[model samples]
Target: MFDIPQLDLKGKVSDAEWQTRVDLAACYRLVAMHGWDDLIYTHISARIPDSEHLLINAFGLAFDEITASNLVKIDFQGNIIDENCPFEINPAGFTIHSAIHEVRHDAMCVLHLHTNETIAVASLEQGLLPLSQYAMFALASMSYHEYEGLAVNPAEKLRLQQDLGMKNFMLLRNHGGLTVGKTIGDAFMHMYDLTRACQIQLQIQGSGQPAVLVDQEIVDGIRAQANIVHTGLTGGQKSWPAMLRKVYRTDPHFAR
Candidate 1:
């Protein structure tokens, strides 16, 4: 993957953009570290700081192989914005991300994944049950979008935006899970929580006993608290530094 010497874009772009690239790259590494990556598929995108464009992993790069300089910059319409970028963005992946970024001004980063547990939950008749605290956390801001095949059709964009509405978490029926955040860390943290929730749900469901659902009142209270907390601070600020440290310790190349 490193056959060509990747450009060092640290000083070429604005500091804000560079930092966004670093965080987004770190996010990809973190996803791979957690074993949630779907090989070279799936995508995580971050809106360029103060711009209409976004940075996404190049179409062929594995999550662990992504680097700050290797990410591609593209407009919402999938046009490559950086003339020197050496990679192509996947059209289907761009469709999913651009659909969200176009309307969700609050969503600075959008993450989507298709893990065994997440897919297991999505394929169920009732998606993402409120069976655990982790589930409750995701349910607080979650919405569901009925699967519409591969999401490549241009018409699906409007439907995706409409289904997403104002929610920060989404379950793409028969597909997988999605999360949005005001920062890359926030988005990653949401996906982590949602994935944990799905894991717990699958375990409980496998035990052959009916699940004990959380109380609706308590769920409502937690949702309210989440809104307050996220409004006060970005979702992962307190933990993101440690997360980046962990990523660097594992492999510092993502920040390159």
Candidate 2:
């Protein structure tokens, strides 16, 4: 078995919530390793599995450095309940994440990022085109939101929620990408596939050559296939545990 290094997150959260924190923390690290994490600005959140509130990264920690015990727990109002750490949580990021968690009853985890490819693709007038197999699934259920500065205004939440309407994937125009899932596994998987799809599209576009696109009818079929509801809700149960094991090998504190 592969072992992961442990990074200490000083706190005393429960076992289940701690597990969520660990997986989310690993997501931050893995995203950084994949070049998807953008400094400390973007955020990833999980809905504490059974709670209405969310578990999100503290604003100051680099994605690669976050650990479970360090994750901040806050209500929908953004009030922090776990206070062992002094890091600030991003209010704007929460506004975006909270809106989704509030409306999307099925969503358990929400991951947001401003990766270069995601932003570049979002900026394009065409958006994420169906040039790859992954794109077919990505574009099928994706929503687009026109940029409105830094997403700081409370009024924008309404439009953001409206734009996201029923779709699990969103492209923040001129901004970046956001994915929601009923579980960390699902959201992460969506992001993993979606990010790679965007990277592939952007790379192909840079070639300045026309690329073949997928058929719309087929694209819809793929969405139906990818829908995890028909599947099971333990989104990251299989692979994420493996990732946790990897992270734990180096240091076991992620479960703290």
Candidate 3:
């Protein structure tokens, strides 16, 4: 009988925002379970409702090992709210995530992963080619940012934002992949799509098979379809808490 520290969410957060955190956190663990986590390197963030702050995982914690209580409340400047989780914020993580949060108000959740395929694809001279329907959606909505070492410098934020304008997705050249969604579900879904697209692109590149980039018309159509994503992740309307339940099944310390 292990006791998990579940967030009551009865008063602190609007019902929607609390659930977004839970689902966004779940998506983090799911990323780990799917072998997408790089120890403490990558990050997932969910914008706090009625506020400019976001719920981000404490730096140094592995994604799968993250829990709701372990999450940190950080403002756009990376100033952490005085809370229970004892850890320093990853300035670089905040630098990258906060930039998106400031501009993409629609982005309720943001996910950035350094999956191997993503890194390989990022390093490629030709980034994210439109080969499949997924690629079409990706290339249509995705933006590109050149890497300037670890994303800590404030100077890089404007450039990063410039590259990520309006699109909500980006391939950080020579780095990895990033996705911002109106909901945690949408962000997670976008990550899955971009990750798969990168994998296929890398595999195709390896095979030296000529990738049949989808037609421009089809690419535009795919973008239109992607726009239609009904993000159930709308502030944890039904996601984060459910995933937390799964974490509880494993161990409840995360909520503490």
Candidate 4:
């Protein structure tokens, strides 16, 4: 029943920054629509194109409540860049998101979620298996980061960066899932494919029957073909327009 405070920066920011805000806000709304939101706990950070400043949701706002005008702009060290911004960034979210953004220069967006199915899969000792095509897609660029308590400590950044390497998808062991993209849409789609793969894995495991795993050679071939067709951020751009249309139909206020 809480109402978010009014935030209007329509004429204050540059055109590129405003568009980044809108896209990042739309990403939050899409995450909520997909039922991946964990109240106000999770975080999604997007870079401001050519700037070092990044956009993140205020710690207390629900994903659906996030609007373009409401996201806080912060620097790499988690300092609020906008003096007028009232809300503080989440400390833990900062430690996690900023670490990736600090080194992953090519990544424009970093999405971390704690959905039930994704957590379940992350808790598995064997990690995600390629039981389906969705799983294969995830396995293509996925890596695993061993969980280290609250992730608020700065020391954990080194290990996290090493574990993540150049992978786009990361399974935070005993924690949750992570996806980094050259664009917001790419990050969202990465999480979507990972979430689906986790759901399918859970369903298959629940059936108590032996599952057929895809051949590694075939999996590698398909991954190569996918790379050939979808290069860099182009993969996300292909479906981003449709995603924006879906978000607008669901609720246009996210872009406000």
Candidate 4 residue spans exceeding 4 A from truth: 228-233
Q: What lDDT score belongs to each candidate, Candidate 1 first? A: 0.90, 0.80, 0.77, 0.91
Best by TM-score: 4
Model 2, residue 50: C-alpha shift (Å): 2.5
> What tens digits encode model 2's per-residue C-alpha lDDT throughout 27-103?
77777767788787899998886687688887877776777867788999888975544666898898899988888
TM-score of each: 0.95, 0.87, 0.85, 0.96
lDDT of 2 at 114: 91
Task: Report the CA-based lDDT of candidate 4 relative to the real structure.
Answer: 0.91
Q: List the candidate numbers ranked by TM-score, top first.
A: 4, 1, 2, 3
**Of the candidates numbered 1 and 3, which has the greater TM-score value?**
1
- Deviation in angstroms for 254 in model 3? 5.6
Count of clashes in candidate 4: 0
Clashing pairs in 4: none
Question: Which pairs of residues collide in model 3?
Answer: 16-235, 19-236, 20-235, 20-236, 22-240, 23-240
Worst 10 residues of 3 by lDDT: 230-239
**Candidate 1 Cα RMSD after full superposition onto the native fold (Å):** 1.7
